[model samples]
Target: MKAELEQLKIEAFQLLNRAQDSSAVDALEIDLLGRRGKLSTLLARIPELPVEERSGIGTLASSIRKELQDAIVAKRGQFSAPTSQSLDFDPTWPGHSPSIGHLHPVTAFLERSADFFASLGYTIADGPEVETATNNFDRLNIPANHPARDLWDTYYLNPARAGLLLRTHTSPVQVRYMDSHKPPVYIISPGRVYRHEATDASHDTNFTQLEGLAIDRDLHLTDLLGTLEAFLKHTFGKVKVQVRPSFFPFVEPGVELHMSCLLCGGKGCSACKQTGWLEMLGAGMVHPTVLKNMHVDPAKFSGFAFGIGVERMTMLLHGIPDVRLLLSGDQRFLEQFHY
Candidate 1:
């Protein structure tokens, strides 16, 4: 019986050393140590022997099973494939370069635009995209019955609440700010605005607008023009701006501000509709009634306000032909803007 136990251990080690994979080692373990296996069969035979001889044979079988299990475990390790680092690695070797990501083009432009205004003593302010008709229109001199409200053609969130809706412009932030603050307020509100409009190369249903509002004892159209000029020059590097008479309910004597097409340098081009000029933003002195609606005495304080379309500015600066490209998730288009 002791000789049989020694032979079992030798057979288990030979099979374990020849194991090509973990599965072969597992099979060998069951053949050698499992119930009814060689070691277990020998242990079972011990019960039929005399008590003194039974103890010796049982001890030898247990020892043989233990040694076989250890050999199987060690052999399984030898069959495992080496890790990549263990097989081929140098401590001084240059590592694989990882690709880094950057901000979206619109976000990049928004931050730079805010920075330009922030440098000019304007504090950035924000308000909700979902707004009330009173703040968006009534407080902006565009009542429910007013024709100017048609110009916005907005998206209504609820039929109740005097027409709760996604704000058509960032001007509501100006109204919200004035409702809580007094005169000498300087704020620039940059936010997403919604309009119920058809998508085109030039227009999008959703876009960004940066609204500027500054109120003081005396603020004039000249101040508004000068501010717009400085902003345009700083943003576009010395571009010509043209302001023409326009109409907007929120501001009196509203004017449309334009810049020479950066693509054409004022020469006729398809992007500018062969006109060589791009309408950049709208600006004017705050209407007295709009101030009165905010409960700020219009007679004591006057201000200038302008709303600049951020996407339009991005298009002009980057020479992007389609406004849709700004909203498109095409990585090729977006990856061009690294900084």
Candidate 2:
């Protein structure tokens, strides 16, 4: 029994010395000191020996076990030295750069546009995306027969609430703003809007619209033209801007603003359908009925309002090929805009 104990002590020391790593040291410790280990097995046999012999063997076993445990711990420390040294990174080493994020192109445009308008004394205003027909349509002078009111053209929220729908444009904000405030209102509403329409490279069922409204005495089409031209020049950096007579329910003599296409340098392009002009936004003198509906005197005050599609502006600004990409949440597409 003493010979076997001596053999175990020699074997344990040899294994511990050869252990080059923590895993190897762990295996050696388990083999020597575990419940079913060599030491435990030999200890269990102590009762089989003569009473006087058991005491000598047991003492020897305990001493050898403690010596082996101490050797394993020391060996493990030696194995860990290289690992600890490897962790002492050079203080001057260049660290890995962290990943940075940026805003979506639409949001970036919205912020810049807000800043531009703010510089022009236009306060930002907000309203609910879910709105009533009175604010979304009727107050804007859009009637029941208007194409926009059709279920095919708009999203209705509740069948019970006949007029409840997701706002088709931020112009509803203009109505809501006028409802609660007196005239001399100068504000821009930039927000998400929805349409019940098909998706394509140029069109989206959901997009952003920025509506600008200013009401005071004697506002005219010329004033509308000048305000929009200043805004476009600031946004597009001195581009050619023009307003042509057009029609919108909310504007008495509506006009659509057009800018020369940057793609073909105003010569010609598919973007402008072989024409030099790109239809940008709609503006006009606010219709009398719209003011009357909001409890503002149509005779006492007049105004000009305009609506610009933020998605369309973003696409033109970045030369993005698809409107869907603006809201697709594609990190690859968005990472390109990081400044």
Top of the candidates by lDDT: 1
Error of 2 at 17 (Å): 18
TM-score of 2: 0.71
Q: Candidate 1 on 174-243: residue-level lDDT in tens?
A: 9888778888988999999999998876689999999999998889999999999889888888778788
Q: List per-candidate RMSD values in Å.
A: 6.6, 7.2
Q: After superposing candidate 1 on the true structure, give the runs of residues whose Cα lies further than 4 Å from its correct spot.
A: 1-95, 160-162, 267-270
Query: How many steric clashes does model 1 contain?
Result: 0
* Candidates' C-alpha lDDT: 0.86, 0.84
In model 2, how large is the Cα lDDT of residue 305? 91
What's the TM for model 1?
A: 0.72
